[model samples]
Target: MPGHAGERLILTGPLRLVPGTTEQILSRLADLGRTVSTEDGVTDGLSVLALSVDDVVLCLPTVIMDGRPRRWPSATVDRRIDLTSYAFAEPDLISAYAPELIEHLNVGHADQMRQLARHARPAETEGDIAGVQVSGLDRYGLDLWRVDSAGAEQVRVAFRQPLVEPRSLGRELRRLLDQSANTSE
Candidate 1:
């Protein structure tokens, strides 16, 4: 595969609770590599990125470290997340959006990841979900965006609640992205 340039998208607002340690997060990210197909998953490895909760920012290609209330940009988002505010929603959006990636999955690449990230953080824009400020999202949450290599975008729910249970939503999104190709053509 040839090297490709990437894009930068971010998720702003409030962060959720991180479940693990930074060391563990780094190690897991390293092991997971860039492609989800190559990753073993958090069950066997580490959520690495999951550790972030209230301060977590799920950008494309990689995860970001939360700044202490003064992260260059604003503290929370007005309505939608933004770059620099959190980081890229689909850190992989760039590579996935490559012209070559056009045939990679049935679903659209960069756009798909953005869609999922938005859906993952669905909560009270009032800045409170499950008693916490819904700041950012991670892989575990952005599932709706996932579509097979060739599938079409078929979003079901427009909004989500609880925010936590929906964390599992990422699985469904991934499945969709992985199967999107099959569904499209």
Candidate 2:
């Protein structure tokens, strides 16, 4: 979700490797409009470096593999993703209301959460499941956190189409729930 810092793609890593003062680096990066692209490769990966807005060096090393995801010596891979172009995302009503919406869905619509999760990952719904909650959301989808006997995982349930109007959120959500129920039946 977009915050006050701006639209940032959060990459999981230790802050130590983020060069310069973390706050300064992030602020500078936000000011300069840029996007990062990665290629699928093995141990012999390419490191993409670019000059920051403040003239600092930004080293972005990417490692994406093909086929079944396996534990790499230096990195962890849970799944494979396609190389697609990302459109510029501006902060919208969805981002602004995510916290309240997430809380509402989790507290008042737990059953719907289960329905959406089950529709998204039916195999994972079987047996003694512990809980399901809406962890996040955007115009396109809801991010669900599911916990069961196996463990916990986040699943993204995308809407049939991208939401264009903030006022249509309720209608879109109802459509998703209805679709899920129909699919199960």
Assess each prediction's global lDDT (C-alpha) against the native. 0.37, 0.64
Best by lDDT: 2
- Candidate with best TM-score: 2
lDDT of 1 by residue, 1-185 (tens): 12232223333345454466656656566687743333544444434233232343333332245743323243333233444444454244423333433243224445555434334443412332212112223323322322333332333432233223333345455664555445444
Models 1 onward score TM values of 0.17, 0.51
RMSD of each: 18.1, 14.3
lDDT of 1 at 74: 33
Clashes of 2: 0
Going through the candidates in the order shown, the clash numbers are: 44, 0
Q: Looking at candidate 2, what is the lDDT of residue 66?
A: 83
Q: Which ten residues in a row have the lowest lDDT in candidate 2?
A: 52-61
Candidate 1 — what's its lDDT? 0.37
